[model samples]
Target chain A: MAFFRSHVLVCVDPECLARGAHDVIDALQDELVDQGLIDEIQVLETSRIGGCEDGPEMIVYPEGVHYVGFNADDVPFIVEEHFLKGRIVEKFREMPKVVVDEELGPLRPKEVRIVLKNCGYIDPTNIEDYLAVDGYQALGKALFEMTPEQVIEEVKNSGLRGRGGAGFPAGRKWDLTRQVNDFPKYMVCNADEGDPGAFMNRRVLEGDPHSVLEGMIIGAYAVGASYGYVYCRAEYPIAVETFNIAIAQAREFGFLGENILGTDFSFDLEVRVGAGAFVCGEETALIASIMGLRGEPSPRPPFPSVKGVWGKPTNNNNVETYSNVPQIILKGAPWYASMGTERSKGTKTFAVGGNVKKPGLIEVPMGITLREIIFDVAGGMHEGRHFKAVQTGGPMGGCLTEQHLDLPLDYEALTQAGSMMGSGGLVIMDETSCMVDIARFFMDFTQAESCGKCTPCRVGTRRLLELLQKICEGFGEDGDIEKLEELCEEITKNSLCGLGQGAPNPVVSTLKHFRHEYEAHIYEKRCPSKVCRPLIRFEITDPACTGCTVCARNCPVEAISGERRQLHHIDQETCIRCGICVQVCNFNAITVE
Target chain B: MTAPSTERDIPALVRAAIEKHGAKRDALIPILSEVNLALGYIPGEAFKEVRKQLHDPTEGVFVAESQLHALASFYDMLATKPRGEHVIKFCENAPCHVVGGKAVWDTLREKLSLKNGETTPDGKWTLVTTSCIGLCSVGPVVLVDEDLYGNVTPEQIGDILGRYE
Candidate 1:
């Protein structure tokens, strides 16, 4: 085997792949082979890099110098200057140091980065890369050094709650199954990250699959489970593929399969790819899907810990929750407990997205304020747009406004503020966003995903959607607000599972925080943000009109009129309200009011 | 539409899918997914064949046809009806909508002359709205078959759809 002094690790994650990183990689490899430098320098492709905004970025190892935003043309220069000559390419150093704030600076580390430590560093497909970083050592330690009881005790002491939104203590869940006395207890790693805006779990599975595997192995040992299944959604093909490879590699390394690491304990895992269904993220629904049945959540009391997959006791934990287990085991429980708040322990990974300047996956210690996450970690709202609200926790979650920005983010605090810490999907919204539309959007999602097992969820969600749709379409009645409030309460109280019970969160929270916007939509027949098509109209303001004819030319339905060098008029009669004219108007003449 | 002869031949295809999974009841979703991959949609004949295979008294575990159809109809990826060659899944969730998804959605519908969940008359494209594909950072996203197009604008919709055919 040939060894190289330096490695060129490129970013080929989803975002980077979308940005033509593959072509740049192809160019880099061709250049390297042409220069006869393949033996001297090893080229590797790592995952997300976290700094997705400055994509197609790569690092030349030994120096640890990162070059950002490079294309095919810049590769030959980097290879010649950095690899061939022993000098760093100064011109290609577009990304400021990891600490220093660059142009899109919030990608910097205000984060503790426990969960995301290996994400941007290692090649996910290669187990050797994972091993080099002390990957399976946690599982080895748990299997050999500590007793199963000791491992469970450590987890209990750590206060590591479930990151899958419910915030149930991981140790307590395992203990529940351990005491069940059921044979063949199963451990399922819920990689079905169904929360729309959240890709934190996806990144963990794609960038560091083995860490989750190691975590699952430790959980299996602690909970006395012999078989495990990873239920990953089929939409995330990359995550599914990477996890399968990790499973295969671990089996080969003797970390999985019978008598792992020369121990009496035996555990094996297989991947059960989920067909498209959002509700399958629920533990019961997930178990049903794994059983090749319709993914539907049954009532609780008899949780998965009591009777789960194939009628055996099962312990299901979120990917992030499981990923944290290995770290909690490797480092002592107290060490893990020391990072987070009094109640919610350790770090939380959030897929920070939407209108943020530098949106990407970030892991920060608990008790970090939302303001800090938005402004310090994510660089605030993009394009100087004023902050409206940040929607966390997907369909089951609510939106928090500027007033709640300084609130410490943890399970209890968020719940107290009327939102749950639901899988940590923080979607930053700017002033352009309409709270009514946002509420309706989440309603639409839950309504579609409702499994129809319960009347309240299946029927109530449709009614809530109807009310929301009525408000958005300028048909909101006098008693619409009261009707909505009553429906929200009824749905929350009567729903069978989390999907229905938490379905009204978007509406309730929007009513609490952005009530004035809702009132405007209902009473005045006006969308405060002008997002509702029926409530707003695009008009050419004469003072700002340059008569450029750009709006007229770009109108999808020929709604704008008037000749070049003359004030144009928007023909509302013909307009489809597609917003193409507003987008194409160069003179700042178009206004939606 | 499949010919009557082709409909008769579905049992062989269904048997191949059943044989792949050893006719286990727990492998029903995988079988349906495999059959959906082989045939464009899980036809009524395919489900009947799967039901027959599942009830094989020797090796197969019993699974009712009602249960199979219920499982099949529940999943968004599985379709009972015939679909177009290319499936265009547009993200219609809040994050995508917040970042100009409505304009792109409008353009797509107008250009294709089809509403959401409607396939083109020529059977070239099936437009459907998905909740999220977990790439919300680059919002207003759409997936044509396997290829994902992110940060999609109304103008880019034409070029993106153009590449599909």
Candidate 2:
């Protein structure tokens, strides 16, 4: 093997690639060759660095120096000044280099990472890279040292529950499968991470595919299963590709095929990609979809553990839940149990995004408060915007207000606060976000995603959406509030699956916290946040206006009229309330009413 | 999208797809996905071919063409009608919708001269609304074919779409 002085890791994640990180890689390589330092320095591309906002960023290893916001144009300077001359490039330096540590220094993790340990640290496509970081040690320990029942006992002691929204105990699920008398049992990894704001599963599958595979293998052993399937969404092309490579590599290493490591236990794994169905995230629906059906959820009487995929006894766990198993086996139950709260043990990974300062995949301890997650971990709201509310989970989750920020974020606490932990999607909203519109937004998602098998979810979601639509359009009647509440209660009580049961959460929670906003939309015919176009209007203040004609020129509907060095006015009759003038205006002259 | 190949021109191709993944009754979705990927859209003749290939008289298991068509229409990714040369899937979920997605949606409609699920008259582009593509932090996300564009602003709509054709 060849030894290199430094490793140049350029981020080529979707965010950075969109920002021209590929060009930067090419330019850096070309510059290194031009300077005759190509052989001396190794150039490589990696996944997301967690600093997605300052992407097209790279770090030089051994020195651990980070360079941010540099383009292809600055590559020659970087090669000459840093790689050749051996001097730090102060112009592009994002942060001071610290002594090398196991954790990510450049990204500066706000919380400990257990589920996301291998992500961004190892190359997902190469199994050897995963092996270097003690990849299969847990599986080895589980297979050789501990018996199948002992493995389940350790998990039960650790109190590790499912991270896939339902919060069921993972050990209990495995025990149920182990007790069931069946031949050719199965284990499944639910990589169908369909939550709109969550991509932690995508990151894990793309950055450390073997970790999930190793976790799945360990899980299969504990449950007495002979076969396993990893059902991933086809939307994540890179994740699927990486996982397939990991599976092939594992099989080659004698870790996946029949009689792994020459033991009596023989197991095999295959990949089943979903066809763009959100409801498939539900375990039963996912099983049905894997069986080549319409991906509809059947009511849970005999849970998936008792009778699952293909009408056989099966154990199904989400991507994050499976990713936690290996660490528990390797480190022991006490080490894993020492981190989190009383009931919810260990860390939970969340995909934090929206109007936050730092938006990326994060893993925090289970009991971390929403305030700490939003302000401390995510660096607070963007541009110092006032904290309005934060929406966790997905379409099924509810929006929490400022008063709920101090509440510890766990399955029980969030559910008690009128929201569920869901699949760990923390989307922060600023003052500009309207609660009524937010409810409408979630209603639209559930209404469309509802499979037609259940009438309550299918028809009730449509009716709730219609009521929300009427309210947002300034056509809400006097009795609309009572009617909405009645419908919300009825839907929550009568729905068949989790999709329908949780569909009313957004409206119910928003009404609990921000009913005044909804009242304004209904009675006063106004959007308090000025987000609903039909309820809001735009006008240019004369004092703030410089008569730049920027808004007038850029208006899609040509609704604004003004002259040079004069005031501008918006024709309400012609204005579609698209809010283009507000975005285009440089002088901050336009105000929403 | 694949090349504009008719059903009659690709019987061998259709038969090969069915042979590769049509052994089980549940292979209906994967078979449709493979055929759509190869022939752009699931043609009526291709459905008939899938039915014929899956019709195992000895096994007492036969897949109907109506079942294949129902599976095709149920999933958003599978389209019975051709979606032109390029397909654009815009995230219309709440996360994207709250973060100024409506403006970008309107701009796309105006620029492409088509609404959701409508293909252009020139057969150059098809616009559709998707629930979410899982990049919620950067709202107003657009996926053109396999490429994902995040935090898409209304002003960048024209330049982004121009790269397709």
Candidate 3:
């Protein structure tokens, strides 16, 4: 309960632990005790504070000095200088790499900051900071310079497709909504970013709320809409709060309310917090949720552009798509179109995660190869592990293998390769990741998040999950793989909305690429990655066991028992297979087969 | 936390919510969210109170109690049943799973002795699995009430849970 002057957080990630991080910790403790500074300084174990490759890493507070690649030998000097003398050890200090923002993650080399221009650069709450960066200039130009038809033409010339999974032309959507002579038309900003791993929209909404507001105001002006609603997820309380603040500020600055900037284009917006529903990401479902309905998607013959939000003409765009508007407006259409490929224009921001050395958000221009993104941007596989497949999108997206590494990351190229851009959530998997288990993981997500409006998504996804569960639990039949493929096709075809239609993507894509892994699970009853619990067993190897009894003491179920300095035995019957022993063990003693 | 809401306060709570957010079909979600925020969960009587108090003559939208219950149950955030003091939401999606989330999830279930969507006997903690909240870089993310902890390991689970109580 005693407060300490300094807290040293040592990285205890498995990769760092494997590289003698414990010895380093032990040395630091011994040195601190020897120096009589142990009482003043607290050493806490934290996981993955960047630079995992250079292990035995620790960060000193409140200076926030990061030190890496030091072993037990360097600990005494570190303690003597930093703790006692108040001098940071220059030898072990890790250089601040690339101006890492705590919220936005590290700024990478290949990142293009079009949508994320003011993300980490501006104070999101302050309107003056946004105005200093020419935030509302685009709105000004849109109102003063261009007509409604001309604005649509400029967007059409830019060749910017929607960033929200479906690559529909934004200009065409706006035109369609503009053409509808419906009074009290609506412009809804779809901020209900329900794609599990995708956070590009969240960052934008949280970081620079005005960008989205500016875009929405301009769109409302063009589409001749009086009122707009930003349908943000209630889960992201920060985004909703920030967006609400932005709306108020815009009204004050005359960017939003009636006769904005004295032009007679009257537009106002409010934040509609979505009650947790993944299907609400769909336009129709989003519209329904805004109306305080069950967030269930009906038939889409009449899209949101035609009839939406109280059965009036509505235009809905993803958060990222709307954020891109100001830049597209300020800069000419050709300037925006020049960055990406022929079909897809502008840079895309990806929430790159999973088994990568540098897992964070990266914005890269379109047509960049997957290899460049995974290797150059995300810093490749973690701990030099072998590459497996990369899952793009979320549950609705597919897994792409090494064969598609060189493929350009555009909408057409990705869709052609059995994957879609899907809000730019790219999760990189390594050799340790089991393909079957990965597919099952996504299937489980899609199955749970299904709105149950239709039979195919509600029932078909459940059946698919059951088949996957049967296979993973070593209860696979011979025809289970074929059965999965047939079911995926049925679900894909028969589903009413995008939720049901795209729910089979992970299964279908994984089946297409990693059918052999599924075959092995069904035919041999073996999980190659030793991930499926029933198919794999934990054991203590005799040679590698140092008789330390670390695993024995750490075992939650008391499954391991042995004398001190003797080899331990695991009681398979009692072992719950929680993998705690393996994580706690320092020696390479435990093996799963 | 605030004291549990009683049946007598249900009508007052519904009336206040209707006053705050207008008595329209579009205001139902915000109203329900406010009620959920005030009370841990919306009581069965509160739905009837809401239906009675909420009447949008302009839109001709007067929702039924059944419709109100349907909405309250559909969204994961709004709970119809009584919940624990602290809600612990663990990410059970693919992004977390691929990066050692299974072990953390297992450790959490073991530590709390509660399965998904179950509250403790003491009503101190409720464990529920949620889809990803976009902190993918720090996989194995856990949200306890409003505090979100990223880069969560099984070893850190006990400490995190202890912080809430």
Q: What class would a CAPRI assessor give candidate 3's docking?
A: medium
Give, for candidate 1 chain A, the lowest lDDT window spanning 10 residues.
Answer: A98-107
Candidate 2's C-alpha runs over 4 A off are: A1-109, A546-548, B6-8
Q: If ranked by DockQ, best first, what sequence of candidates would result?
A: 3, 1, 2
lDDT of each model, Cα atoms only? 0.87, 0.85, 0.87
DockQ of candidate 1 against the true complex: 0.60
The positional error of residue A551 in candidate 1, measured at the CA in angstroms, is 2.4
| Alpha carbon lDDT at A357, candidate 1 | 80
Interface RMSD against the true structure, candidate 3: 1.4
Off by over 4 Å in 3: A1-106, A561-566, B1-8, B56-59
Question: Comparing 1 and 2 by DockQ, which wins?
Answer: 1
Q: Considering every candidate listed, which one attains the maximal DockQ? A: 3
Which window of ten consecutive residues has the lowest lDDT sum in model 2 chain B?
B2-11
Q: Is candidate 2 or candidate 3 better by DockQ?
A: 3
> Each candidate's DockQ score against the native complex?
0.60, 0.55, 0.70
**Runs off by more than 4 Å, candidate 1:** A1-107, B1-9, B58-60
Report the lDDT tens digits of candidate 3 across residue range A255-357. Answer: 8787999988898889999888999998998999998899999998698788998899999988888888888889989999999898999898888888888
Residue A117 lDDT in model 3? 81
